[model samples]
Every structure is written in C-alpha cells, then in structure tokens.
Target chain A: MNKIFFFLGKGGVGKTTLSASLAYYLREKNKTVYWASIDPAHNIYDLLSLPASPKVQKIEAGLWVEEIDVDRYLRRFLEHIQEKAQKVYQYLQILNLDKMFKVIKYTPAMEEYACLYALKEVFKKHEDKDYLIIDTPPTGLMLRIFSLPFVTELWLKELRHWREEILKRRQIVAHIKHVDFGPGAQLEFSKDKVFNELNAQQKDMQYLKDVFTNPKKTFLILVINPDKLSLLEGKRIVETLNKFGIPIKIVLLNKTGHSMELKELNFFNDLPQKKIPLFEGPFPKQVLLKIASLWVEDAYL
Target chain B: MVLKQIKDFLSQFGQGFKEASIDQIQRELEEMENAFALLICGSLSGMPAPPAFLSLCLLPYMERELKIMFSKTIFLDDKLAVWSDLVEL
Candidate 1:
C-alpha cells in the first residue's frame, strides 16, 4: 500500500468519524481506499449510517469498508494454530485441542493477537490499494496491538535459540545410539518442526515491527478532543510511540469549539496540529466530505 | 552351512562396522531429551509452562520425553509397590 493511516485515540474521541472523513477524501482524490474498523465498539457504520458488514464492502468506486469481527478473527487464529499443530506434530490430535483452545480463548493478550492477525491479513490482501485507513480500537487495546509484534518477536527469538540448543544435544545422542531416537533425534536444527514453527513466527513478528516503525509508509494520526483527559491520553500515545521509535505524523485536535482548555495540549506544540470544528449531532456525509479539506489535505495529501 | 554362516557374520559386521554402544553418552543423551521435554511442556505437570500458544505445536515431536516424564512420575509415586507387583499374582 502507498500509505497506511491509523486513527488512534481514546473512546468517544471521534476516531470513527475522523477516519471516515480521511477515507472519503482519499477516494475523492481518485485513490483506491480500503477503510476498516478494528475496534470492537465499531461506530463507522453508525456514523455513515451504512449497514454493518463483517466482510469488506465496496462503497462506490475506489472505496471499500469493513468492520472486522475481532472475535471471529480470534477463532480463526486459533484454528490456524490447530491446523499447524496437526501438520507439524501429527499426534497433536490425541490432545483435545478444542478444550485447550477454550482455555487459550481467555488467555491474556489473545485479543491483541487477534487484532494483529487481522491487521496482517488486511495488509497482505489489500496491498494493491493506494491508501489503507484503519480506525483503531480505543487507546489501551490499540497500543497493545501496535506493540504486540515487538514483544512477541523478543519471546519467539529466545524460544528459537533454546530449541536449536536442544536439537544440537539431540544430534549428539543420535550419534552414540546409531539410531535416530524417535523423531527428535532425526532432526537437524533447520529441518526440525518446532524450530521451523518458531522461525516462521519470528519472521512474521519482524515484518509487523518494520511496518509499525516505518514512518514513511505508516502514519499515526492522534485524534483528541480539546479536553484535559483526551489531551493527557494523547500525550501518552505520543510518548509510547516515541519509545517505539514510531513517529506520530500529526495530531488532529478534534471537537475544537468546546471550551476545554487548550493549555493542556501544549504537549502537541512540537508536532503538526489541525483543528476540526465541534459539531452538535451525528456527522452528516456532506459534512464529512467537506471537513476532508480541514486536515486530510494538510496532514495526508 | 559353514560358508553360509560365515557370510551372515560378515554381513552383520559390515552393517554396523562403525556402530558401538557407549553407556556414558547414552545416559547424557537421555538427560538432554528429558530436560528438553520438561522445559517445553512443563505446564502439563503443574510446572510453569511456556505460553501455551508457543509450545502447543511441539507436543507431538516431544512425545518420547512426555512418555518418559509420565513413567518417571508413576515410578516416583510408589516405586516399592511397583517392584512388589513384579512377583506376579
């Protein structure tokens, strides 16, 4: 994709509406756009007053929208793991995988894993699109999603190292036995099933880390209302991205007309900022189409 | 019969002219395999397990180690009882 724009903010910060406006603008500019909401509390359909679709839907020419069912993605992710387990370890079927998955379903970071899975799918499938816009989940989950790749990479790397060492020792045993001791002894480090699995996971995590940390290909648009809490959360988002070396391209000061003190937002003074007028009710398509000029051109075009 | 027997002896020797059983190496190899299994799937025995997602796939490849673990656990539970049963009913 030419560019990936992630609209990130706390809940009720108009992430859905703002991202929709950017998607509309990009399509208006004749760029092929794929807009998706990875948030569980998706409001993209409501804001546009369009029917909710679990799959990607074409909206006129050069535009597609999807509201991802993250839970479905989670289930699919587990199925993928089970399928791999079957192929890599044939006897895996003896274990009641369904029961194990039921436990994994509630495991910490599974939601984040699901979101990462969905994100990779979108990137791979829609690479031909000129611009991809993702309306991210609220702050906590979205941050975790962005950082999941980096954290997972660290873990899988250590696992791979230990697996190689195990294989090395196994080879020593096979030498003395003059027989391949079960399956483990027969494996070279490169040829082992477990080592290969770990290698694949490491590669995927590194790819995601590259995508998130690359500033030119990916843009982080922080959406915050002109209020104390939103500004504080926005600052934290910026700081976290900085820690990851991922640049925040612009801060969209949403709901500007409200009398929330701007003094709190001095944190954003160093970065690019754009103001969008506070509207009274549901965002009309006409208004979204018009507001595109306010920040889309300045921030993206 | 003498010629056939000589041929058979030669074939057996040729098949593993380099093969030899070494007890020390055998024991060390067994130890490595057991440790590998214990580290990866330790959670099955109420030990601190690796993240299930990461280790779940390797269950089949570690089948030998797992069996060893179970046998060892059983033996540890009542070694004397197991030996007494050797007398037969």
Candidate 2:
C-alpha cells in the first residue's frame, strides 16, 4: 500500500522545500517515492537542482519527480467532455458547442478540478510506488481541491436519487401511453447512461473522500511559519479539514524563531509539532539532504 | 385541398388525444426533465451548477430536457409562444 503525504499551508511557507525534503528522506530510507508538485508555481525542480520538466524524471535509484502541468490536466479534463459531447450530441451540432469546450476552462473551481485531476492521475499511475509525496498549492486552492470530493459526492447522491425518480416517472408515462421508450430509455438505473455516469463519478468521489479522511493511508501535514498571518490561515485549514473529517497528523513549524510554544496557538496544540530552526540557504544537494535528515529524525514519521 | 385539411385536423386531434390520456403524468415527466436539467446544468439558469467535469458527461443524455429548457428561455419575450408545442417540434 502506498502512503501519501500532502504538504500544504499558506503561500511562501516553504511547502515545496519541506515536501522535497520529505521525499528525499523517504528515498534515503530505501522506499520508492514519487514526488509530485501540484502547485501552479513549481519550485521542486529548481530546489532539487534538477532541470525543470513537466514530465516525470528519475533523479536517482528510487525517486521519481514531476512538476505537474496543471493546465494540461485541465485540457485533458475538458477534452474528455468535448469528445463525449461530440459523440453523444451528434444531433446538437448546430448549437455550436465548440465554444463551450474552449470557454469551460474558466469555470468556477476549475483550478481545483485540474489539481484533483493531477492528483488522481498520480494515484492511478504510481500505485506501485511505496510513498507518494504531494507538494500542493497554497491554502485556498488546496482547501477547495480537498473538499471537492466530499461535497461533490453528496451532490452526486442527490442526483442519483432524482435520476431514479425521473426514470420511474418515465416508466409510468411509457406504460400509460403504450409507448416503447426503448431499453435505454432510462426505465432502469442499470441501462441508463446518465445514471451509470452518476454512479461512477460518485464512486470516484467517494474513493477520494475515503482516502483523504483515512489517516492510515494519508498523512495530512500542515507546514506554517511562526507568523501571525500564516497561523491564521493554518487555523482555517484545520477547521475546514475537520469539517470534512480529515485529521491533520503533524504540524511542521518551519523557519521558527528561537523557541515557540504550541500552547500559544491553541488550534495547533493537539497536533504533534516539529519545530525547525531558521536556516540560511543556498542549499546544494548535500545541504538539502542534511536538512532532510534533521527533520526526519524528530518528525515522528 | 379539402381532404388534406381534414387529414391535418385528424392528425392534430389524435396527437391531442394521446397527450390527454396521460396528461398529468406527461406534465410530471416534463417537470422531471426540467428539474434534471436545472440540477445538471444549473449554470444555464444562474443556479449553482453541479461540477462541470461530471455534468458534462451527462449532457449527451440530456437532449430532451435541454430542449425544454432552451425553448422556454429562447421564447421568454413571447408570452403566447406555446413552449409545449415547441417541445413537440
């Protein structure tokens, strides 16, 4: 079973650095690890001194890394719909829906969907790896992506119910009219394309929801600076994830001042905190590996 | 010409009779379709839309419902447009 570690917090909080460190640390432990940067602004390649490429590259014996091309994911997501739409909606050609395919990239929550698409692709492709370290975007976008599955799953359930009702009414209308609406007329859930699509989407959403909220499989690590603004965002992240039943396993207080107390921040008190002292960096591979070793030793991973 | 007119009248009458046989249920079915479309493509009506990635897949199966939706909206200015007949068209 591949365990996933997601590193996220407010912007400029060293998420990429910390996630890269963890990926390195895990690889050192002889675990096969895939490091994915889901952030729109990627830093893993530059930080790792590896040439920047969206394609996954093997940096060493056991590590694979990619800065996910998020827009490509968005394109793929839309293209699947456009392809299906062109096929199933052959009679609707006059509506000129090609514009819709181009325009839907600007849809609300589209960035989150793209990020989720990237994450899902990683999960499907890298299931054989031992550990998957996800380097995520900032607080707002990450929260939406995290909540997308749970919220949409609930909506899908409602859609399924309504679809059943619609199908039953179709049966009634068909019977009363002595008309054959055909086997695919949605008289049954099994033969209905809409219903089956709804079910498949719901199942995918539920799978993601379960994996996100499941502690044993996923470690939700929050990295925050010891600043007031970052802590405020961190508090909201914790509250929102709690609302969705995703428990944070650890808090990495990166670039901390001399000494800070979790007791001072009540929301972060329950979480296991690893205080990392501020370090000046022009971090080479050796320096980064050293930092990873230090953080790994006390993080209780 | 007289015979053709009678044929048209009988065709309209037969269509009306078929509709009258299940008028209430027929209306309920229409309502169901509109509801399904609103839920699936709520963005069209300024309603909170479902996730586009998921809903787009359902659009291929929504020709009937979507036509009902558009017929109403496209004729919103015409109060006597008889949108139900438009649905038949």
Candidate 3:
C-alpha cells in the first residue's frame, strides 16, 4: 500500500506550494510520487506552472500531477448509481433518473462526498506509486471530509444489520415452506439484491475507515500561517483530528516572517511544528525546489 | 367420511398458523425496512441526514423501502412529526 500524505490548512496559507515542494522532495529521493489536488481552485497546476488537464500529467521522471475534476467525477459516480439501480430494479429505466441527478448537484455535502469518491478512484487508479500527496480543499471543507468515513461507516453498519434481519426472516419463511430458496425462491430474497448491495457497501466502508485511521499508512499534515487566525484554525483542526484519532504527523507553519518568534506560539507547543520563511515574490520552481531541499534536510515528521 | 373430517380440521388449523406467522413476519420486515430508510434518507423526513451522495449511492438498494417511506403519511398522533398534520395539507 502507498503512504498517503494530506496537506491541510486554511485557505491561502500556502498548502499547494508546500504540497508541490514535498512532492518534489519525495521524487528527489527516487520515490515514485503521485501529487493530486481536489481543491476547486486548481492551484496545484498554477503552482507548478503546468497547463491544466484533467488527466494525470508527468511533471518529472518520478513525479506525476493531476487536478481532480469533481464534475466529471460526480457524473461518473451518478452513472454508476444509475447502472446499478437499473440492474436491481429493471423499471428504473423509465424513471428519467439521469435528469434527476442533475438536481443532486446542488444537494448539501455532494461535493465533499464526490471528492472523497474521486480521491478513492485516484488512489486505485495509481496503485503502483509509492507516495501520494494530496492538496485538499480549504480547512472547513477538509475537516468535513475527514469526518465523513466514520459517519458513513456507522450508517453502513446499521443498514447491513437491517438487511441481515430481513434475510433471516426470509430464511425462516423458506424453512417453514420447505422450499429450496435458491435464486428462484418465492421471495427470491435469499438472493436478495438489497442484501448483496449492503454487504458490498459494508466491506467498502470498512476498508476506507481502516485506511483513514491507520497512522503508519496515512499522515495528515496540518499547515498554518504564523498569524493568530491561522493558528486558531489549525488548533481547531488538530482538535478534530485528535477526536477522530487521526495521527497528526506534523504541523507546518508557512509564511513566517523574520520578526515572528516560534517560541511565542503556545497552542502548537505540543505538536511538532516546521516553519517556512516568507518569500519575496511569487512562488517559483527554483524557490520551491530550494524549500524542497531544506525540507529533506529538516527531517519532516 | 370420518377420516376426511379429521383431515380437513387439521388442514384448517395449519393454514391459520401459517397465515398468522406470515402476517407477523411481513409486519416485522416492513418495520425494519422503514427504520432503515429513515436512517439512510432522514433528510426527506425532516431529520438531519448524512451526505446526499451516500443516500444516492444507497438508493438502488432502497428502491422499495424508499417507496414505502415516501408513501406513508404522518398522522397527527404519530409523534414522529408531532407538530405536523396540525394544519390541513
């Protein structure tokens, strides 16, 4: 399994820049790196000065970059839903669900779930890569995504239990009738479509939850500025992660000016903090490369 | 004639048991399905729902239960929607 690294922070706090630098640093160590961003703003491509494309483009020999297009991702996801629905309920073909899905685009939490689905797709698609660097959405949205797997797993477990009960009842009826309730049983619930779907979903959710909570396999790197507001947001994220039991590998403090003293930040006192000095102009490859070199030397947690 | 009378009596008794158990089982299954629907798509029923995307993902499996959930009306005494049905729809 690949080691997953997530760059999380408040907006405009240099997450994309740091992600790019980290990816470069990892690639320099001869590791195959896949750097993907789900940020709607597509700042990763801008940071790399690469032309935007939906497909993964190779930035260097071992480094690949891609911006996940959530619209395309959601469309495919809906298509998958439609296909499964039509297969399970043959009458679904007449429902015009394709048009109905257009309305789902505006639903709450759709984007975040879609992003999660897309991230899973990306990881599955590039299984050969050794390292995966993710530049996630802004802090608020990112935290919501972090909390999603646990909530979804809980729901899946409850659903699976109900499905199992229904199947047990069907089995009991089959026993009373002394009928071979194969796929051709009167209720045909032994080969239950719903039960099968719930079973598959349960397994998928379990795997995702394991992936998220495993510290050795996943690292959530929180990025913050030296300012008060950014540190406060970072503190909130750390608290949330701590609640979720997600390991905080490192807290990156970006854009620290010469005058700011790291010793004064009490909130980050318990966590391992890495401070990146504020730069003069727009972040260029050379500047990012220099930071990448320094990062390798600093022994990132 | 005596044997036939005894056989008919036993068949009727067996039929009653079968029908009663089937009814009980159907009711239990329906209740379980309804609770499952509420858990999955509670937003439509006015509860705090999870992600809509997840609900949609589970929609294919819940087609029948979803039908029941949407069709059932909350009566005034139903406690589920305590304030609802106060005004005529």
Candidate 4:
C-alpha cells in the first residue's frame, strides 16, 4: 500500500508551502516522494520557481514535483471516449457516433470523473514512490472532489436507465430496418463496459476514501492563519468533515506570531485532536525543515 | 418543453417518494425547489451560492410548502437550457 498525505485547508493558509516543505523533508530521509498540486488557482509552480508542466521535475535528489494539467486530462478522457466509439463504429458500421461521444464527454461531472481517472492512473503507476503528497483545492471544490464517488454513483444509476432506454429504441430501429440482428447485438447498446469501468473507478475512489478516513494510512492537516475569520472557517471545516465522517488527524496553526502560547490554545477544545503551532515568518528552507521535523514528530511519535 | 422536463424530473423523485413518508417527500421537493430558486437568483445577481445559502434559501420554503401539496417543483438553470432531453429530467 502507498502512503498518501493530503495538505488541505482554506486558501492562502500555507498548504502549498507546507506540502513543498514536507516533500523536501521526506526526500532527505532517502524516501521517494512526489508532490503535486490540484488547485486550479495554483501557485505551486511559482513557489517552487518551476514552469507549469505535467512531467515530475526533479526538485532534489529524492524529491519530485508536478502540477496537474486538467486540460490534458480532459483531452485524454475525450480521446478515450472517441477510441471506444471508434471501436464500436468500426465493428457495427455506425457513422456519426462521434457526436454522441462528444456529448457524453462534455456531460456534468465529466471533468471530475476525468480527474478521478487520472488519480487512479497515478496511484497505479506511482506505487513504487514512498509517499504521495497532494495539495488540494480550496474547501468547497475539495469536498466535492472527495465526495465525488457518491455523486457519480447516483448519476451512474440514472445513466444505466438511460442506456436501457437507448437500447430499446435501437432494437426498434433495427427491427424497422429489417437488419439481421445476430448474437451479441445487444452488446452494442449495452454500456456495461462503461459501467464496469466506472465500478473499477469507484473501487479506486473507495481506496482513497479509506485512506482519507483511516487514521494510520492518512493524515488530514487543516492549515489555518491566526485570525478570527480563518479560525471560524477552520472550525466550520472540522464540523463539516465530522458530519461527513472524515477523520481530521491534525490542525496546523500557520502564520502565528511569537506571542502565541501553545499551552494556552483553547480555541480547538471541541476537537479531540492535536494542535501543532507553526510560527509565521519568511518561511525559508530552514523554517520549513523545522515544520517538517514537527510533522514527523507529531505523526510518527 | 421545459414543463415536460420538469414533469420528468419530478417523476424520478416520485418513485423514491413511494417509500418515503408523504410529509418527507413534500419537504424534500420543497427543499429541492428552494435550492433551485437560490441557484437562479444568486446566479442572476452575480453572487456565488455557498453551501449555507442552499440550506438557508431552501429550508424555510420547504417547511412552508409541505403544508400545501406534494407537488415537486423544478427550476431550470440558463446553462441547461440547450439540452432538449433535460426538459424531461
């Protein structure tokens, strides 16, 4: 099993910085680590001072980084649909099937589904890597991404009904044309392959859900700046995650001044979790190393 | 056509409602309608409909409408207007 770590919180709470630092720290331990950002409003490249690309550029001896190319993922998903449609069309002598494929490729939840597909691919291919750290999007979209399995399952049920109706219509059309309907003709109309693929994808999602919900395999660190609004938002995040049965292992109080006392931390009394104090500063490599040391101590010890 | 789509969408929920208490179904439909209204009004007003807004806009309307009828209400977003089959959903 691969060790997956997600650094998530509201925007501008040093998630990217923390994720980058962790990746660096893990690399120093001679562990293979890949750090990627999934936020649309990305600054991982800027933070790392690297160009935007899909290739995992070597940041250090054991550390690698990449930003997810959503457009590339979308294109690949569309290509997969086109390829499947072409296979059917070549065998069945059907023309203009690309239009339907295009429509399906652009449906609601399609982009999210494509992203999930990419995740599955990443998990499979990067099994050799010791750690996979992801800097996710802001709370709302991140929640949607994590809860995608439930939404996709609901949509799949409706789609299965739609597929059956399409099959019935196709059968009627075949009858009217006086075509010789042979065995396995129903396979053309049956989106069972697609459904099966979706099921497989769901399994991958379940794996992630397990990783997210499991305390040992995964750790969710909610990063927050020391401010009233940010603290309230952090509280809401914890509450919402609890409602959805997501286990929040740690709360990261980022950008705090030296005046704050860790012993006097009463803001998160409701949460039965550890609060790690990360002081605010220029955030140099040494500072990040200090943060990583804290993380290793908190997580491992 | 829009009306037909609304009717179709309602019918899907109707099947689910068979197992649900009448009050629960009515409340759920009203909640759905409220969500729809908020999406429309917020989008029109150039404001993003946050999660709290969904609950705030829909919950009261649902509670009030549960007293009237078991009718399911549907609102179409402008973005979904192009889908011919969506009218039935």
Candidate 5:
C-alpha cells in the first residue's frame, strides 16, 4: 500500500468527506492514520464534527486529525527562516525583519509558499504513520503546490551556481591581494552559510519531489462529482499530475447516481475508477464509516 | 642598478594590473548582485519578484548585496549600461 494518499478535486466535490471516510476506514483496519486538511477552505474538521482550529488532535487509538492553521503555520515558517538567518547573517540584529516581513506577506505567491512549507512540515512530522491522508485544496492551487518543488529546485540550482561563481571570484581576488577574505572564503562552498541554507532548502524540496513522484510511496486519488464541470476539472488535474510525474492511483466518482452512462466518459478510461453514492444527509462519522465500509477492504487492492 | 629598476617597474606593473582586474571583477559582481536582488525582492520597487516567502528565506544571506543594490544610485541616463549588464547576465 502507498504510505501517503492525497485526495484532490474541485471545490464542493466531497473530497473532504471521502478522505475523512478513508481515514476512518483505515483506522478500523488497525492502521495508524494521520489525516490533515491542507486546503485553504478547510472542511475536514467540519466533516468530522470536530472543532475547526485544532492543529493536531487524537481522533482515536491510532487515528489523528489536523486542520492546518495557515496563518500560524505561515508565521512559524517565517520564524524558521528568521532562525536560520540569525545563524547565517553576522549583523542580522540590524535588519528590521519584522518591517520587511510586513511588506513581504502581501507579495504574490506567498500563500503558496506557506502552504507548501506547512505541508512539508506536516509530512515530515508523521512519517511513521501507516497512512498519511491529505485533503488538498481546489484544483488550481493544489496543482501549484505540487509543482512548487520543481520550480524551486530549478531556481535553487541556478542560484547555487551564481553564488559559487561570486565566491570563487572573491577568493581569487583575496589571494591576489594577500588579504584574508573572511571566514566564508576560508570554508568550502558547501560549508558557506548562504550555500548551506540553500542546500538545506534544496534537500527539503528534493525529499518532497521524490515522495510526490514515487507511486509506491504516494498515491493521488482524484475525487470528482458525476457532473460535467467536476469531470472536466478532474481531467485537467490528471493531465497536470501526469506531466509532473505524480501517479494518479484512482479516480473517485463521488455523488454518483443511476446515470451510469457518465462512467463511459473517455477521461475516466485510463485509471481505476470507483463510484460513491449520493448521500442525503450530513456526513457524520457514522455515515462516513458506513460509506467507508463499502470500499475499505478493496479500495487500494 | 638598471636591472633593479626594471624589476621594481615590473612589480609595480603587476600590482596595478591585479588591482584593475579586481576592480573590474568587483563591478561585475556588484551588477550580478543587483540583478539577483531584483529577482528576489523586486516587489519592494514595484517590480514583480519571486515569492516573498522565498525571498525572505534568502534575504539574510543577501543582506550585504541588497544594501549595495539599494544604495547604488539609479541613473535614467544609464540605459545602455543597464542593457549591457542585462545582456551579459
């Protein structure tokens, strides 16, 4: 079984419900489950009938639930950068980091970075779990989150190269002038503080990249409604995921009805497909458990 | 005595050449630093930059370069020079 499962779909397509049900299902099988909602429009807590603000809470003997507090997580991410910066910058105390951060929080793509950082942290923290279920954001943002590591890795490579070139030049000049070029010049490029920090970030990104692309370790389950719009979005998501080398293990047709003709759509032909019946009432834990019982045994098999 | 003079002149020439090369390299490095700062923190100047969270992550290591970039005078008349630097990069 894949160690990690990501539930992805359009908004209001029952991704949270299906993912929560899967977590509950896994718990019944005596598997350790860590279920997290990484979507900005978080609904996992609401679906599970728990308080919304809990970062991580015990659901049962082996299942844990978390609704990521994005604001707090973003602040923690900034704090992480600040701590690393203090170690790297000799005069970090002089910089008005708070003021700078106030400006930075409004910049484009900051939310995406924060989301990715939080996801990475959550994934790292629960590596020992038998199953890690992620309820991702809506299609567009979730795709961006998945693609972030690739873009980040590319930029980091270029940045590392540029940094090394600059350092090499500095060392050469120091040698010619017979001057001590400071501690940075004395150390190998990998040991240089700036290089080391970039390297650390690269390592984190690479770990995620590997996990995301490896099918045996990670399974992407696309949750879709039987409606046309959801199917369209799911198609695009599947294509993008394929382009990024993330294997889509299953296409979940949620809120499915007797119009079995929707199953014949060409988009669903490529992957394993499962249909979920339309439920009439609120999806409480009991309802989810009943729904889960249908597929828990053979869902991944 | 003549040989000694030649030797002294050669040493001075070598020192001057080294100084000039260092100066040119420093200028090139400075230009690269400015471009890099703009790549990350261009939002500060109303130019589109990479994600602020990432820029913030890199800002600590780039404090010195950014300071130089911010302090350097911007000249409207230096369009050609700016073009050349961008082309070189």
Candidate 6:
C-alpha cells in the first residue's frame, strides 16, 4: 500500500545515481524512504560509496539504501528447496532425488526467482516505510521481472494439471505396492506445499504489477542520454511500456554534452516531451542533488 | 512448521483448481507465445534483457499471463523450475 517509484532505463543513463539522489531528497523532506537496487550488476555500492551489504544503510535522516544480492538469494532459495526435497525423499525412501533437485535448482531462472522472492520478502516485511524507490535492471531484464507474474501464471496452470496427473500416478503406484492409503499418503504425493509457496510468490508479483500499473502509486521514469542509441532506446522503452499497459510518468534526459546543435535537439521532439537540463561535470553528489531537485519539482507537479 | 502450515492452507484451493476454464488456459498460452516472441526478437537484436521498446510491446501479453497465473492457486516449489526458465529470459 506504499508509494513505489521505479527509476528505469537503458544502462549508462545514471538511473542509479538519479534514484539515490531522489531517495536522498525525499528523506530531506522528512519522509521515510527505502531505496533498493534490483540490478544484478551491483553498482549502487560504488555509486553511493557504501559497503556491499544487504542491510539498509542510512545515508541521511530518513533515507536508507539496500542492494539485492542475487547469488546469495539464489543460494538460500536452493537451500530451502534442498531442505524440503530432502524431507520428501526421506519420507518416501527415494534415493538420489535430492541430487536431481540440486541440478534442477541450478537452472537459469533460479537466480531470477530467488531475486524476486527476495523482493517479495522486502515488500511484505518493510511496510512502515513511506517510499520504496527501486533501481531496476536495464529495460529488457526488468520487463521480464516485471512481467514474471503473468508468465509464471501460465506455467502454473499447465503445471497444476501435470501435478495432479503425477499425483494420480503416484497413487496408483502406491496401490500396486499395497501401501496403506492413509495420512502418510498425503505426505507422499501432495503438491500442496510447493503450490502454496508459489502462490505466495505470485501474490508478490501481483503486488508489483498493481503498483507498477497504477500511475498514482508507481511511476516509471525513463532515463536517457542525448545520443542516437540512448534516445532511440528511450523512445522504444516509452512505446514498450505503453504496449505493456504500464504508464510512463516522465523521461529524464541525463548527461547531454554541451556541444549539441539545435537541429540535433529535434530528435527529442518525437518522444513524450519532459526534459531536464543536462549536467556537464561528473556525477558527483552536487550533480546528483541538482538532478534530484529537478526530479522532485517535475514529479510532484 | 511454516512449510507444513503453508501446504495445509493451499490445499483448500485444490477444489478451485478443478474448475479452471479453457478460455483462461488459451489466453495464457497466447501470452506465453507473445512473451517468447518478444524475447526472441530482443535477443536477435542484441537488446538487453529489459529491452525498453520491445518490452512495451510485450507488456499486455505479459499482464494477461500474470492474471491467469495468479488467479488460481498454485504452489511455489513445483513451479520454481518454470519460473527459473522465464527469469532467464
């Protein structure tokens, strides 16, 4: 139920720097803020000069920063799976199922699922905060993460049917073995445990979708530089968000070198026009502050 | 103990699972197809994972998929592999 702000764009557009400064500015206004980075590259530490730890680091009066360590999260998630699977294995007397599950846990989406699970935990546990600002990964990965609830839902449906069939098959096997069909039967063939955890995860994804799709609560600010590639990328992002039904609240053009001519500026007119002045120097605290002030002025209006 | 409680809680939704509609399944399949298409296109174009432009194109389909996936209750551990595959996208 808290307001969530996402600073998203292609990489190298100062999304992290902008997000950090904005969080700082919001804190100055006496609002409790939790600025989290969902980027796998882990640049928030270097940008903010904070230690690489998951616990919130107080940067100002009411602002705190945290980074999601995907690997660690994945390790923990896999460990949970291993623990649960071990319980099932021990109960069923199945040999080597644990090893097979370990291999499955190492698959590609495992890390992403772990990261998302971490996001769900944070949202659920950190309810007292006023603002939650997210520094998402670049557009593509971030979109996949954002859209995961949708994609996973389809898989879940198919999986439900498949699981039921598997359960039925297990029951037949139990019958053939003349095993007593009693309370232990539930433990032997139940899909309820796995489904419940997934349901919880889907709820988290739904929370994100609700927040993201709502213009009043979640604002997607696209960050861009004044170059052909970045500008084109920004335009594409704008269009993509619209296509996905996620609102794009504003576009922040960062780090435009002072040498561009008037004709070059014409390229930006094609975009949904909200422009912030370009800073000339490196993205130090002062420059970040300036950007943050501009963002606050624009975002509030 | 928490895990057991969670399982017991989810078993309550098992009845609804029997009532899934075909239209919902078809709609979800379409969404997955679109997402897969977008990912393929983005990868071919060398675009990053959250390709801004293409993701916009994929968002609605993605949203549809989300709605379908979450409406009926499914457990987490069983679908971890499916989720892992999608996240890799």
TM-score of each: 0.83, 0.87, 0.85, 0.61, 0.86, 0.64
Indicate whether candidate 4 or candidate 6 has the larger lDDT: 6
State the lDDT of candidate 3 residue by residue for A237-264, as single tens digits: 9889888788788888788874566543
* Model 3 fnat value: 0.55
Query: Which ranking of candidates, highest TM-score first?
Result: 2, 5, 3, 1, 6, 4
Q: Pick out the ten consecutive residues of candidate 5 chain A with the lowest summed lDDT.
A: A179-188
CA lDDT, every model vs. true structure: 0.78, 0.81, 0.76, 0.60, 0.78, 0.61
lDDT of 6 by residue, B41-78 (tens): 44444653432222222222233233333432244456
Stretches of candidate 2 off by over 4 Å are A180-184, A258-264, A297-301, B1-21, B72-89
Runs of candidate 3 exceeding 4 Å displacement: A86-96, A174-190, A258-264, A297-301, B1-11, B67-89
Docking class of 6: incorrect
Q: After best superposition, candidate 1 residue B49: deviation in angstroms?
A: 6.1
Off-target runs (Cα >4 Å) in candidate 4 are A86-108, A154-184, A187-195, A258-267, A270-284, B1-89
| Model 2: how far residue B57 lies from native, Å | 2.5
The digit string of per-residue lDDT tens for model 2 on B17-59 reads 7677676676777778778888788877688878877777687
Give me the runs in candidate 1 sitting further than 4 Å from their true place.
A83-95, A260-263, A298-301, B1-52, B57-65, B68-89
| RMSD in order of candidates | 5.6, 6.0, 5.5, 14.3, 4.5, 14.9
Model 2 reproduces what portion of true contacts? 0.60
Docking class of 2: acceptable
Q: Write down the worst ten-residue block by lDDT for model 2 chain B.
A: B80-89
Model 1, range A243-271, lDDT digits (tens) per residue? 88889998899888868467878889999
Q: List residue ranges in candidate 5 displaced over 4 A.
A: A80-100, A178-188, A258-264, A284-286, A297-301, B45-48, B74-89
Residue-wise C-alpha lDDT for candidate 4, range A1-301, written one tens digit per residue: 6577888788888899888778778876788987887777778778755677767777777777778776577677666555654554455454465565556455555566555656666666778888888888788767766677555445445434544553454444454444432333342543434334434544665666665677776667777776766677677777777765786767777767644544334567654443347555556677778777765553441
DockQ score for model 1, please? 0.24
